[model samples]
Target: MAKGKEVRLTIVLECTTCVRNGGNVNKASTGISRYITQKNRHNTPNRLELRKFCPYCYKHTIHGEIKK
Candidate 1:
């Protein structure tokens, strides 16, 4: 990771129950600054998660990236 390097990110919208909130994940907002960390021993950014409130659900939920 270099200074001022841009990381590839995907913002997914989710509900408190871990279910897909909207029709797709890409329709979510990305205005917030996210902190990403490695999920496994390999030290790669495998897990993409964001904690945010879903207006549809009216609660905080864990939004995970949807792989194509």
Candidate 2:
């Protein structure tokens, strides 16, 4: 017998604004924010984009899926 493929997949999300400015590697008032989450491969085939709070940015911004 065979088993089905994985339905849930883990993904990484990063702040768009911070990345645009450049990689804020230093620990200061600003830096790139990343989040770890899971998604259903079948339900949403496209990349996931979510609105989340960026502590570094001091506001909410769009967090797009990034490669591992």
Candidate 3:
């Protein structure tokens, strides 16, 4: 982890079984998810990247920026 760059990320593993089985019943914070999805969809922030994860889902999702 980078100094002063460590962040809290919430992610989804895209597990269909989890979704169908109600494993993802709990609502996760979608802040990072929305940001990543937007950037990935538009292909913006080219080359700029950041690492994030969802502790609940145990997914290693990525983001463009880290929040304080």
Indicate whether candidate 2 or candidate 3 has the larger TM-score. 2
> How much lDDT does each candidate structure score?
0.44, 0.88, 0.40
Candidate 1 vs candidate 3: the TM-score winner is 1
| Lowest-sum lDDT 10-residue window in model 1 | 30-39
Q: List the residue pairs that clash in candidate 1.
A: none
Each prediction's RMSD over C-alphas, in Å, is 8.2, 3.0, 11.2
For residues 1-68, could you state the per-residue lDDT of candidate 2 as single tens digits? 33448888999999998899885634677568999999999999999999999888888999999999
Those runs of model 2 whose alpha carbons end farther than 4 Å from true positions after fitting are: 1-4, 24-27
Task: Give the per-residue Cα lDDT of candidate 1 at 13.
Answer: 33
lDDT of 3 by residue, 2-66 (tens): 74353433322233323344554346632223233223423342334545554444665443433
TM match of model 3 to true structure = 0.23
Error of 2 at 27 (Å): 8.7
Q: Tell me which of candidates 1 and 2 scores higher on lDDT.
A: 2
Residue pairs of candidate 3 with colliding backbone atoms? none
TM-score of predicted structure 2: 0.83
Query: What lDDT does candidate 2 reach at residue 67?
Result: 90
lDDT per residue as tens, model 1, 7-57:
544334334343433333344542332223323323446645667665544
